[model samples]
Target: MTYCVGMLLDKGLVLMSDTRTNSGVDNISVFRKMHTWSIAGERVITILTAGNLATTQAVISQLEERNKAPSDRRPSIMEAPTMFQVATQVGRLLRDVIEGRQDGGMQGEGPRFTASMIVAGQIRDMEPRLFLIYPEGNFIEASYDTPFFQIGETKYGRPILLRGYDRRMTFEDAVKLLMVSFDSTLAANLSVGLPFDLQVLERDRFDPLHSRRILASDPYFHQISSGWSEALRQAFHSLPSYSFAEDSTPSDGAR
Candidate 1:
């Protein structure tokens, strides 16, 4: 399992994905799940994938190949005219890759072949957009009512996002929120480990404004994790204490 989140904010887009993949306790490995493509001042695309490694890798490889050699193939993500088209192309490719594998030799209902992705980017002169693409090739875009997308190991960290996300929040606040979310998830799940890939794109920049990897021992991440834990403790203690009515007298027969 993996954890990836993409947020569509008024400022631009924020994305983060963990780099851990595991088949068992002893078979864990680190594999980056974030991929990006940018044409300097023209456009920028970032994909955060989760699920079957082979399926996601195949989808990414196909996209790269198409972009490198567009003559005999359909439009690649880099060539898509709009963010919507980019999501469409990626969804189609992901579905095709999974279905092709199932048809080739794997069982039809094998869960290991399933994968999902969060597609986000900005096209020249167009607003930034975010999409969560399912394994079936269908996707949903982010809106004010739902301005973020999460894939894999999502349960543990969703509460923080639900209560804290703001469409107008700054990129700095957004990244902090994401770090808290990822930290919460990491604390509860062994499948999701550290060394997260993070990217931030400012509106109209047509390129990433910030990008970096957060390692397990990174000072900032450690500070955020510890600070969040202390804050939560303080908040919990500050809440109104529960009260119960005191018994006025002993039971009639107990005295």
Candidate 2:
């Protein structure tokens, strides 16, 4: 399992993905799940992958190959005319890879070779876009009604994003919100671990405004994890206490 979030903000896009992957407790390893491609002043594309490692790696490798040697054989994401087309090509490739692998494997386990991705980026004049691509080769773009996308180990951290996300928030605050979300997930799931990859792509800029690999020993993340835990404890304590006596229900404000 993994945890990857792509937040669509008015400023641009913010993405983070955990690096942990494992076949079992003793077989854990770290590999980057976040991949990005940019053409200086033309476009920027970032993908956050989750699920079967082989399936995801194959899809990424094909994309990189296409970029390095463009042709009609396969449409390179870098050459896709629009962000929508870039997402379409990636989704198609992901679906094909999974299906192709399954054809060579045993029955009743097609899902084990499946994967999904979050595609976020912008082309020259268009507004930045965010998409969630499924293993079936279909996708939906983020909108005001749904302003963010999360894949894998999503349950533990989803509530934080739901309650805290705001389109008008600053980039700094957005990253802070993501840290809290990732921290909560980290505490709840062993499959999702440290050294998260983070990126910020400002609107209209074909290059990343900020890019970083946050290690377990990173000071800022350490503070966010510890402080968020303490804040939750304090908030719990501050809530109105319950009473045992009959006819002692708390007031509406307390409720």
Candidate 3:
């Protein structure tokens, strides 16, 4: 499993994803789940994926092939007139890959394949946007009420975004928010691990403002995880407690 979030804010866009893949306690590995594409100042996009690894990989590979093709026949993400069209192309590609794999195997189970993606970015003249693409190739955009999208093992990290995220937050604050969110997820689920990929795109830049691969021992992440844990513990203790009076036969002494 994986954990990824794409957040849209008034300042810009923040994309984050963990790289861990776990099948069991002993079966563990790391593979990058975040991918990006750009055309200098014309357009930029990022995609974070979850669900069956094989299916996701194949879909991405197919997309890459088209991009690598010579001349104008490459079916353009870079040249798409609008961000919406780019998303449509990606959605259609995802659906094709899923269908091709599932139907290619003629049997009852048909080689089970399902995947979802969080896509975010902007074109030269368009506003930054975030989308959560479902396994069915449909997607929903992030809105003011909910300015973020998460994919895979999201429950544990969702609350932090829900509580603290705001449209006007700075790009710096957005990264911290994502780190705390990932921190909560790391504690509750073993499938999502560290060595995360993070990117921040300032609005209208049409490029990544900052990008980093956070390792297992990265100091900033370590600080965020530890600090958030301590804060949670402190908050829990500070809350007023409801205690049942000790069950005792005190009346017997009076009798």
Error of 3 at 46 (Å): 0.4
Question: Candidate 2 on 1-255: residue-level lDDT in tens?
Answer: 999999999999999999999998778999999999998998999999999999999999999999988755779998889999999999999989988887886457898988999999999989999999999999999998899999999999999899999998999999999999999999989999999999999999989999999999999999999999899988887788787769998644333
Write model 1 residue lDDT over 222-248, tens digit each, in one string. 999999999999887776654454854
- Where in model 2 is the C-alpha error above 4 Å? 251-255
Q: Ten consecutive residues with minimal summed lDDT in candidate 3?
A: 246-255
* Top-TM-score candidate index: 2
Q: Which candidate number would show the highest lDDT if scored against the true structure? A: 2
lDDT of 1 at 204: 89
Query: Over 4 Å off in model 3, which ranges?
Result: 70-74, 243-255
Clashing pairs in 2: none
Check candidate 1 and list the clashing pairs: none
Candidate 3 lDDT over residue span 1-255, tens digit each:
899999989998999999997666788889999999987787788989998888889878877887887474767676678877777878888888888777876346533577899888898877888888877788888888878889999898987789999888988899999999998999999899989999998888887999999999999999988888899888866766544558632332111
Report the lDDT of model 2 for residue 199: 98
Candidate 3 clashing pairs, residues 3+ apart or interchain: none
